[model samples]
Target: MTAAGLPMEIRAEGLPTRVRIHEVGARDGLQNEQTVVPTEVKAEFIHRLADAGLPTVEATSFVHPKWVPQLADAERLFPLLGDLDPHRLPVLVPNERGLDRALALGARRIAVFASATESFAKANLNRTVDEALAMFAPVVARAKDAKVHVRGYLSMCFGDPWEGPVPLAQTVRVCRELLELGCDELSLGDTIGVATPGHVQHLLASLNEAGVPSSRLGVHFHDTYGQALANTLAALQHGVTTVDASAGGLGGCPYAKSATGNLATEDLVWMLHGLGIETGVDLDRLVATSVWMAEALGRPSPSRTLRALSHKE
Candidate 1:
């Protein structure tokens, strides 16, 4: 049995609660930026995130530089990552070539993406969803054989850019494929962030009934429709613990033209703390890290709470 005197155990409060945080600012947040952040800068950013108590940080993406020129330096960037104790940095691998590069660099974890909406799939991958999955089967198997842990990012879980809304059945189907491919975790992304609480509840319920337990699911939401928080609550209620949040709400949604912010790590931590959920994060230190990145980018943080906190001190 574990020690009953554990300092931060959630059960100490009465009920058992556990939540996991997946930090994505370095990749998801930085990729959408117009300027190509220098490779050195990117590594340093990841270092700061690791210092901020983020256990898992999405360090970079291995897509074609032509497609997302921002992260063309994955091979070099990842090697430069400062040793943040106990922080595991995962990168996004889009295909076989990306996986090969990750393997070469001795990367232990990577993420692949797909979409449920046909039009969005075509727009994003230039192929139908089924065709893209076919292409990924070998890549996923190869990574697994190489002892690389794979995570899948399924975009447009609630709504899409080209398509209006994604049906629960379609999302479920795509998620099933990802899980079947041996992805250790499947991140449900609100690409356009039009998801509402009710929609999230329905989808989570459907997914649970369909046999994809909440434990295998991670929630990624943007604040496009200002509903990320609400959707997050719904997921939490369903026992979905892992959440993907950007430091300082760094990323913007390309599909949702008006969507300017991601769900900020600070804000999410605050809410989770208020809800009596334990995240094992240091808010003051995390805010400092976010402010540092925001300053490096020479932009304002989308995290309203962070902005206020900075001004107060």
Candidate 2:
């Protein structure tokens, strides 16, 4: 039994025994912060995340400095990650210009972001759904030609802050477009954290029917409504193995009001370990890392598990 008196046996049925956590603390997590983190600090954060045994760590974004000034040091940041395996570091690229910056910095993996709703598309990317897809098509094609892996992020998949609920067909169509454009994986994002297990299962079922295998998809959830963990379980039950999490629950959506940050890595690790699923992350070490980051950010981590464990320590 764990210190919390919880049994160590796997709880969820039909869930994958091993889950690959795509760590997003350095990129998606920090981008929403008001503070412009120093490039050296960002580098250190990524290094510590990788040192904590996270297999995949999203390094930074290649967007214009005027847009996301928090990560404007992307050019300076990528080179500091020479110690990390190139395959394990992915940076977010906004368009061909962003892609070019990432390529110039020798990025081997990149992620592109799109939205499932028109309001989000206009608010976040300044384009319609089709326009954003059209913009990403050539980006993905070029990345593939350069032998770089590409991942697609579809935000507001569950519910949009401005548009309310998103339709399943629109979500599936965006997923199909990214896949057809040669993206290696697609991460469905609950930008506003309004998803329930039923919504998650229904969406996965729709994507499955649309011929998108669970293997090619990842789930990115926010804990705004405290439903991130539940939604993650639902996705795992539907056979999604790649899960995106931030180290300390460090970010929120600037475009979507009241949207909390990505799901915490510590919280996800606790649940996955309780389920007897392997994530190859040491729970104590991960918690300590998050607490350390909390100190850096001058606030407590938003993860319940981290808060509890850090207090105990």
The prediction achieving the highest TM-score against the true structure is 2
TM-score of 2: 0.96
On a 0 to 1 TM-score scale, where does candidate 1 land against the true structure? 0.92
For candidate 2, the C-alpha RMSD (Å) to the true structure equals 1.6
Candidate 2 local Cα displacement, residue 81, angstroms: 0.9
* Tens-digit lDDT track of model 1 for 1-313: 1232122323223322757889999998898998989888888878877777778888988889988888888878877874543138888887999888877877788888888788777877888999989888888999888788888889889887667888899999999998898888899988878899999889989989998998899999988778888889888877788999999999965444645667999888877766667787777788888888888899889897687667662
lDDT of 1: 0.82
lDDT of 2 by residue, 1-313 (tens): 2466332666667989999999999888888888888888888888888888999999998989898999899888889998878899999999999999999988999999999999999998999999999999899999999999999999989898777888999899989988999999999999889999999999999999999999999999999888999999999999999999999888878788878788999889989989999989877777778888788888888888888777762
lDDT of each: 0.82, 0.89
Model 1 bad stretches (over 4 Å): 1-16, 82-87, 253-259
Clash count in backbone of candidate 1: 0
Worst 10 residues of 2 by lDDT: 1-10
